[model samples]
Target: MTIRLVLAGCGNMGYAMLSGWLKSGKLAPSAVLVVEPNAELRDRAVALGCGSAADAGAIPADAVPDLVVIAVKPQVIRDVTAAYKRFGDGRTTFVSIAAGTPSATFEDILGNRAPVVRCMPNTPAAIGKGMMVVFSNPLVSADAKRFVADLLSASGEVATIDDEGLMDAVTAVSGSGPAYIFHFIEALTVAAEKAGLPAATARLLAMQTVYGAASLAAESREDPAMLRKQVTSPNGTTAAALGVLMGDDRLTNLLTQAVEAARLRSIELGK
Candidate 1:
């Protein structure tokens, strides 16, 4: 069956997912309707061989998309969802990647019968290395769930949860986790500069090191703690750094606080 996807935003994440779908042959470019109000972004989608619409009204009247992926901000999710009510019948399944917004919100807008999937995707999705997590309402079909998973897999690793409440932690870990990694990269770059390395070289080293370490961990599939131990020879330089980062549970305590703060913020946003 042909999959007609109505992507309701063209921001970085949306565009990235679209590019991945096209590149991976997961979704045909011809079946995608890029619903973006911004002229530049809509044009970018058109350039990639998909149909572009400035608003829901601009979409072809006869078009009943199999899936409507909402990538808008949490603040405007209600309005954007309301605008697409024409497809609220049981035939179309809705997928939202807006953090903090629950599937209940969409069901409330589209009617209780609507099948909504709430998703949290990190920014690394832009590079096709993101963590995409989703939770679907009971009304969602097995086929729809699989289809949505296939679409999201183009972005990166995709996982699902049975409890929607856990989405807050998901938001903190993967959704906000990229920003944490980026901040770490910045901090590492600065430290390298202070250690006598040139600014350009420091930045390159920081970025490459983080990237390589993460890639190795992912491919090795070994426990990260085990990997860290592998790198730390007894009483060596890496061990010295680990002492600072791990001794007294410093890094673990700090990261726990950060993630808790983010999870609380996610809960607040949902309210």
Candidate 2:
């Protein structure tokens, strides 16, 4: 199928997905339409050889895009979605990446008969290494699901959830998880600096260690628990560190609390 995509809101996340789609050659510029109110962003999309418009109304009334990707913020979703409601003739599917907003929100705005797929993607999507979690309403067809999944593959890993409620957990884990890692890196760098190492050296060590460990975890067939045990020799430095973190399950408890907090907040934001 010659898929036609209409991307609303050309912000950082939207632009990253767009760039990935283009780079992957999954969709041609001519087959994509970008609707961004920002003049500069509209020009940027136009420069990329795609159809650009300041509003969804600018799309020819005769045009029936296969997918309409809503990449705007949650606050602006209602207004942004209103622009594309006319396409809900059962031919177009709506794919939203707005955090906290539920599939029902899109359904209410776009009409209950309209197909909607809610997706959560993190900032790492800009580097094409994002993890996306998706859940769709019953209105979505199998073909539409496959189409949406293929489009998202341009960014990085994509997983579909049978239950939309799990999206809250997904948001807490992977969506907000990156910032936690970044903060950990920052804290490790500071600790290294306090250890009498040069600031530059400390930063390099912390950053590279995190990157290498993450890469190893990704490539390894062994479980992360096994990997951690492999590195923690008896009565060694690693064990000493683990004593503080793993002792009394302190780290696990702390992280569980953090994730639960994030999940509750996600539900609040959705409201």
Candidate 3:
């Protein structure tokens, strides 16, 4: 069956996902519909040859999409969702990528009968390297779940959790994880500069080092601990650096606290 997807927003993340779907050829432009209030974004979608509408009201009544994707901000969820109530008779599955908004929120707006999938995706999704975590309502069918999983794979890795409560932790981890890596890159660059390297050289070294290390970790058969040990000599520079970082388990402790704080904040935002 041809699946019709209706995207409610066409901002950065939404646009990236749409582009990925089209590029992967998993979805044809004709199979997609976009509703974006911004003229520029709507025009961009149009340029991609997809059906574009400035508002949900502009979408044809006969276009009963199989999946309605809510990519708008959480604050405006209700406003955007009100446009699709015509499909709320329990036939369509609703997918949301708005952070901090729970499945219950979508259920409240889309009607309890609507099958809702709440996903948290990070910024990297724009580049097709994102990690997405999803939680779905009980109403979602097995076939619909598989379809959603396949659609999300266009962005990158996708994982599903039965418990909606775990979404807060997923938000704390993968959703906010990219910023932490970026911050580490910045710090590494600054430190390199302080050690007498030129700013540009430091930046290049920092970024490339992080990129190479991450790639190695991903591709290597060895565990990360083994790889770290392989790089650190008995009393080498890496060992010295590890001494400082591992001393009192300071880095681990700090990261644990940071993740906990983020998870708590995610819970608070959902509430």
Candidate 4:
């Protein structure tokens, strides 16, 4: 099916998805309509050759989009959602990338019968290496889920959860996970500097190591644990470092605690 997308909000995530969808040839520039109140952002979309409207009401009244993607922040979602309620005609499946906002929130605004998919995507989506995790309401049809997944794959890896409750964990692991990786890189760079490397050299080493290791893990069929072991020989420097990181599974326990904290915060936000 030719999925005509009506994208609401053209902020960072929205623009990234639009770019990926277009660049990946998943969606034609002409097939997508951008609805953004911000003139600057809306103009960016139009510059990409998409149809733009200042508001949902401004969209041609006869237009019927297969998917209406809401990429606005959670705080203003309520105010923005009502404007597009007219499109909740069972044919259109609404997809939201708004964090901390539940599907029920959209149902409350767009009608309980509306088909909505709640998705969590990280900042990496801006560069097309994002992790997009989604959960759909029972009302959504099989074909609609498949269609939305196909579009989402343009951004990065697309995963679905059968239990909506697991979304909180997904949010903790992949949604807030990028920040953790960034912080790790920062810490590693600082450590390298303290170990006597110049600032620039330390920074480059830290980033390149992380990038190369992650790339290897992604492409290799071997488990990350196996790869780490492969690099660590008995009484070697890597083994020395592994001893510090794995002593009593210290790093594992710390990470588990961190993920739990994030998971609880995500649960609180949804409430």
lDDT of each: 0.92, 0.92, 0.90, 0.91
lDDT of 1 by residue, 1-271 (tens): 2439999999888999999999999888999999999999999999999998999998777778889999998899998989999889888999998989988889889997788998899888888888999999999999999999998898899999999999999999999998999999999999999999999999999999999999899899789999999999999999999899999999999999999999999999999
Find the candidate with the highest lDDT and give its number.
Answer: 1
Q: Order the candidate numbers by lDDT, best to worst.
A: 1, 2, 4, 3
For candidate 3, give the lDDT of residue 104.
82
For model 3 the TM-score comes to: 0.97
Error of model 4, residue 206, in angstroms = 0.5
For all candidates, what are the clash counts? Answer: 0, 0, 0, 0
Cα misplacement distance, residue 28 of candidate 1 (Å) = 1.3
Give candidate 3 regions above 4 Å deviation: 1-3
My TM-score estimates for the predictions, one after another, are 0.96, 0.98, 0.97, 0.97
Cα lDDT tens digits for candidate 4, 1-271: 2439999999999999999999989889899999999999999999998998998888877788889999998889999999989988777899999877889999999997789999999989888899999999988999999989998888889998988889889998999999999988999999999999999999999999999999999999999999998999999999999899999999899989999999999889888
* Higher-scoring candidate on lDDT, 2 or 3: 2
Worst 10 residues of 2 by lDDT: 1-10
Comparing 1 with 2 on lDDT, the higher-scoring candidate is 1
RMSD (Cα, Å) of candidate 2?
Answer: 1.3
Which residue pairs in model 1 clash with each other?
Answer: none
- RMSD list, candidates in order: 1.4, 1.3, 1.3, 1.5
Model 3 agreement with the true structure over 224-265: per-residue lDDT tens digits: 999999999999999999999999998999889989999999
- lDDT score, candidate 3, position 184: 92
Off by over 4 Å in 4: 1-3
Residue 217 lDDT, candidate 1, scale 0-100 = 92
